[model samples]
Target: MKIWGEIMGKADDVMDICLLAGQIMLTYGAETYRVEETLERMAKSASFSNIHCFATTTGIFLSFEEKKEKEDLMQMVRVDDRLQDLGKVTDVNQVSRQFVAGDITIEEAHEKLTAIAKAPMQYPLWLIHIAAGIAGGGFSYLFGGGWFDLIPAFIAAVVSSIVVVEFERHLKVRFAAEFTAAFAGGTTAILLVLIGIGSNLDQIIIGSLMPLVPGVPLTNAVRDLMSGDLLAGVSRGAEALLTSLSIASGIALTISVFL
Candidate 1:
């Protein structure tokens, strides 16, 4: 009985490690296949057999058996509040590879994963906002806006990004935040154009709205579809569609009111 208890305790730890790794990957925009592969690899490295992993956009299911006793353990992890953070995905992948290569023990892997889970964003929020502004200005130029439009586009993009971030932080509603950001961006562009600060309202609004586009989610959805993860693909695609609609609706509302 004591031996079985010890085995179960070890199995529980391994299960926790796998689940945490999978959760981090899913939350940070990893493909479902990648998450499953990583989970299986980690379990195998820990000497667990009969590994079964199934991952979707919203959850992960994992099971494995101990090689000695053939006892099985299964666990499911529910993932919510997903966002695009390829940096975290890369970090988790590196750790998984290291563990599989026998460079780290399961306890060490768990420690590292815990630290990563608690780590803050790779870039500061202010820097992200600044980058959004720069992207907005560059996109405006690319979209045929004149040199004079750059400042307006930059300002609008910065404001929109701030609004979205702040709104989401407080409300925890993604669609509403995105819609508000788009509307704010469009309105800012129009006002800037009216005040002669921008040459082209359309270009400024287009550029500023680029910051809120679901580019990563949409790309990931297509990639998931190509990878044969139909469930994850369809769900992510739907999410992208809704986000796009929210942004479009906000912009349309702004246009109706101002233009």
Candidate 2:
């Protein structure tokens, strides 16, 4: 009975670790297939023969076969928080591989994941704002905006970034934040043109829109579809579509009012 109890406890611990790892990957914008693969790898690493995992955009389900028990263990985890943090995803993948290689124990892997989850931004806040401005400026120039147009595009991008960040912090909704950013970008571009600081209003607006594009989600959606996760693919595609519409709607509203 004592040995049986120990085995059961270890089984439970392994389940928790696998579930938590899956949760982290799903929450950090990993594709459904990648999440499932990671879970399978973790279970295989622990020498479990019967393991099944199903992951969607919003949740994950896991089942493990018990060694000495009659009933199988099952767990479902909900994933709500999502951000475009590919760095964290890469970090998690490395950790997962290391765990599978037997370089770390389950407890150590859990600790590393917890630290990664709580990790701070690699770049400072100001640096991100600067990068956004530079990207906007570069795109504006590439889109045929004259050298003078870069200045206004840069200013517009910085303003849009600030508005989006502030709104997202307060509202916790991606749509609201994106819409607000687009409106601010459009309005700023218009103001720059009115003040004679910008040479081309169209170029400025187009350039500023670069920062608001949902490139990652759109790409991930296509990848998911190719990998045979139809549900997650459709859901993610819809999300990307809605985000694009929100941006367009905001820009259109601003243009109607000002231009």
Candidate 3:
């Protein structure tokens, strides 16, 4: 009876650990199917043959069927905060793979995941600023902006990235922060055009706007729909739509004011 108790306790602990790992992946912008697959894999690692998991954009559900007890171990976790951190997603995948391969115990897996969750930025702030500027300029050139327009576009994008990064430090809502950043980009482009810094206002503005695009959300939404997760897909699609509209409105409002 004591050995049986220990077995049940260990099972419970593994379940909780798996749930926490899934939660971290979901909250950090992993796809629904990926989260479910990872949870299933983790359960298999613990010798469970009957594990079912359902993950959406905002929540996760997991259950393990116990053959002897004729009962199911169930857990539901609510996820509120969502962010796009590809690094975290990749790290979680590695940790899950390690756990399944018997490379680490459940407690060790939990500690590794926690550390990944708390990991700092991989790149410095100034490097991000430089990359943003280069991306803006390169995209503008690709979109047919002439040589003269590159400098203006670069400057606008750098300034936009800085403003958005600063706003993010204080703003909890992503939409608000994106809108403010887009508006700053628009305002900068218009000012540059007025001062004869660039001849093509449209090119410069478009380039600067590239940074605020919701690429990951849209891609994930499409993938979710393809995987038959209609509700999660629709929810993510709506978020992407709102972000696009916010960006457009920022530019339109700025142009309207100048006219």
Best by lDDT: 1
What is the clash count for each candidate, in the order shown? 0, 0, 0
Assess candidate 1 and give its lDDT.
Answer: 0.92
Q: List residue ranges in candidate 2 displaced over 4 A.
A: none
CA shift of 85, model 1, Å: 1.8
**Candidate number that wins on TM-score, 1 or 2:** 1
- TM-score per candidate: 0.97, 0.95, 0.93
lDDT at 61 for candidate 1? 100
> Against the unseen true structure, what C-alpha lDDT does each candidate score?
0.92, 0.87, 0.87
Backbone clash pairs for candidate 3 read: none
RMSD of 3: 1.7
- For candidate 1, what is the TM-score? 0.97
**How do the residues 83-193 of candidate 1 rate in per-residue lDDT, one tens digit apiece?**
778898898999999989999887998999999999999999999999999999999999999999899999999989999999999989999999999999999999988
Question: By summed lDDT, which 10 consecutive residues of candidate 1 come out lowest?
Answer: 80-89
- Model 1 residue 190 lDDT? 92
| Candidate 2 local lDDT, 133-161, one digit each (tens) | 99999999998999999999999998888
